[model samples]
Target: MLETLVKNSRTSVDAGVYEIRGAARGGRSIKWKEGRAALITEVKLASPSAGWIREGADPEEIAASMVRGGADALSVLTQPLLFHGSPEYFARVRRSVDVPMIMKDIIVDEAQVAAAEALGADYMLLIQSVFDGGYAHNMDEFIEMGHNRGVRTLLEVHTAAEFERAQNTEADLIGINNRNLDTLEIDLGTTEEILAGRNTRSRVISESGIKSAADIARLKKAGAAGFLVGSGIMGGRDIEGTVREMISAC
Candidate 1:
């Protein structure tokens, strides 16, 4: 799955101006303010594990609803093969809302970093396992590229080892993803288990398996600084209300 995602990411990269610019919304740190945990919602159309999530809904509408519900930020999936996401979707959502936005993709190549900058993403998700797999450039190189483009990085890790390595990087946010990308399995406790030893939780954002306010309360008790929810909000009957309820947990 990782190999396929990397190949898909590489094949999709296109040349661009790669212009250097300052942070559009004050450095991706805008998601966390007043010392309160944030609700980072997502515009996920589908996933390899769940398949066709809101297969026909407009990305702009989904993002607008999330903003209406007071989402602290938005995550736009950019992978196209299995996830059914595209950079165009990110661009559409980028134009629709003002909340801090993240370009969520299996980024292994530097061109993806340029794409994130061109799309005006405040932050780009960098998975540690991708570097651990030796698929492309390491996290440090991508993080530097993103910094040069004035795009922050959300370093996502799925294991204790990866989390440890993530702690040593200059990533702006540390994301603990509960879902196992390769096996398509999810365990919400993954966040708690990984963050148990950390002293500061201010920059920790828990991802995956985040469905309800109860899940939010549980993770909050475990010291997660933000929640990156996708399928839960997208799959709900009411996207706006769902996001509101989740934010209410904080």
Candidate 2:
């Protein structure tokens, strides 16, 4: 599955020129202000469930639109098998926008971390559910490796147990995913539960289940420092307008 995904991702045009250095390894540190919720706009071509987000959507155009709409950061889906995204897409988005770019993928090894940095990702995501079941990978080693490469890590968790497991690691940014990866079922309340028990030192982000400005406002009030919104904006006929509205609500 991973090989197929990588192959599909390579077909996209090469986007930009940038390099990722690890946070602890002398690279540019992500300047995350206190209580700032970084808006992560996802760049996806398609997904397992939705198939296609926009027909022939220009990555650069979409990225520019996202920045204009008030995104603090960008999360580009590079997994080819599930999201029809590629590293090339991220490179392009990086060139098109000045905000920090996070590579969103189901990372299973250190090599993927190296690849994310090589592709100019300022951040990388590691889903706790993927490692919790002993899926041939260790989160600790991955986080260490990412930090060594100067890439910040976003530990994604779906439940309390996973959240606890992630807290034990050096991960600083925590993503509370409302959608269960196994079932893809969404529940916004998951964000509340996770936030209520989160470690004070860890920065919190609300991922998925966000659609409108009201949703953003509610999550912000709940102490979410940032939001990872994709489907909502992608599904909208007016991406720029929808993004602006979300920012305004927040």
In order of appearance, the predictions have TM-scores of: 0.92, 0.86
On TM-score, the leading prediction is: 1
Q: For model 1, how does the per-residue alpha-carbon lDDT over 81-129 read when each residue is reduced to its tens digit?
A: 7888887888888877888899898887776787788788999999999
lDDT of 1 at 125: 93
Top model number, lDDT: 1
- Model 1 has an lDDT value of 0.85
Report the lDDT tens digits of candidate 2 across residue range 128-173. Answer: 8776765536678888888877788999999988877777889968
Candidate 1, residue 184: Cα displacement in angstroms equals: 1.1
Clashes of each: 0, 8
lDDT of 2: 0.75
- The per-model lDDT (C-alpha) reads 0.85, 0.75
RMSD of each: 2.8, 4.8
